[model samples]
Target: MGIILEINGFKYFAPLSSFKPKHKRLCETIDFIKVGIYAVINLNNMFPAPLNLCKAVQIENIKNEHYRNLVRAKYRIIKQKTEQIVNNAKDVYNHKMINDGKSKLSQRCNDFRNLELKCKEYSDKKK
Candidate 1:
């Protein structure tokens, strides 16, 4: 035989075989146990300790789907902003290189590629 207990919107199965004789007798006397168990244990009194930093951080990160979507959207916005900045910098650098005319065409192209690679590296590191 087993008893089903509901607590905090969750159901827990506690078999009679697992309980002591005295506990079984106590449970059997409860009339409303059939409907649903209540106040079998006070969870607030059971734990007075604070969670560790890592556990707190993990719990904090457990967001609902809406919150997760918002964070993802924010990240995309920031990434786009960074990319725009990088593109503008590239344009300005290319203009300056063209005006100076000291570098060969291939060298200017290589420099632009290096600048793009640096921007990508920065974005990756930010992520």
Candidate 2:
């Protein structure tokens, strides 16, 4: 529900996953970024999320101090890597499109082109 990245005119919302033991063994790649030990940003799992279908997280409403601070810290890291994330997502999308989803990376990624079409359909319905 965090990190809205716009790639190819569609807004993509990548999911942030808390670090698991499995993550410790996996090296961070272009599609994956580690935010300290707290979470991992999985660009491969990103999906188009139109603004109307998204809700803003109110940090102030987070009653737990530890959780609020963790969220803030995570956002700070995400902000600093915004450019890399954008570029990486674009590359991943292009790779998926150009290769017709045959590569391993493409297989790992969500069907971006299909999701974009779906996004357009949703937009047209709203109009």
Candidate 3:
């Protein structure tokens, strides 16, 4: 014989042979000796495919999407920020060249136009 008790959502099970002869009060009890019997039978059919392969595909898809998005964002930020930095440097260089009389205004203007074309090409590629 066996007895099971559920008190405050916790279960306690004991063989009836263990309860002493002097103990008389049992608040509530049931007979459910083998709680794991059903689980033992159901576990064998739980996975139809190889568990490692299934998990590998799921993890790979998630990681691939995350890395793809991160790389694309990194490229765009680097491209745009680099273009801005180069344009600022070109402005300083143009000012210095003009003040030092090292290059004519036409040459500085041509360099600026080329920088603009490169920026436009980058923007077009992004679209």
List RMSD in Å for every model shown: 29.5, 1.3, 34.8
Among these predicted structures, which one has the highest TM-score?
2
Q: Ten-residue segment with the worst summed lDDT in candidate 3?
A: 38-47
> Across residues 8-121, which tens digit of lDDT does each residue of candidate 3 receive?
222222222322333333321111111221111111011112112222112334467775564444334434544443343344344533554454433332233334355456
lDDT of 1 at 17: 26
Rank order (by TM-score, best first): 2, 1, 3
In model 1, which regions exceed 4 Å deviation? 1-61, 84-127
* lDDT at position 67, candidate 2: 93
Q: Which has the higher lDDT value, candidate number 1 or candidate number 2? A: 2
lDDT of 1: 0.33
Per-residue lDDT of candidate 1, residues 79-120 (tens digit): 454444334333434443464446443233324333445545
lDDT of 2 by residue, 76-111 (tens): 888888888888888887888887758888889888
The list of candidate 3 runs beyond 4 A from truth reads 1-77, 101-127
Question: Candidate 1: which pairs clash?
Answer: none
Indicate the residue-level lDDT of 11 in model 1: 30
TM-scores for all predictions = 0.19, 0.92, 0.18
CA lDDT, every prediction? 0.33, 0.85, 0.31
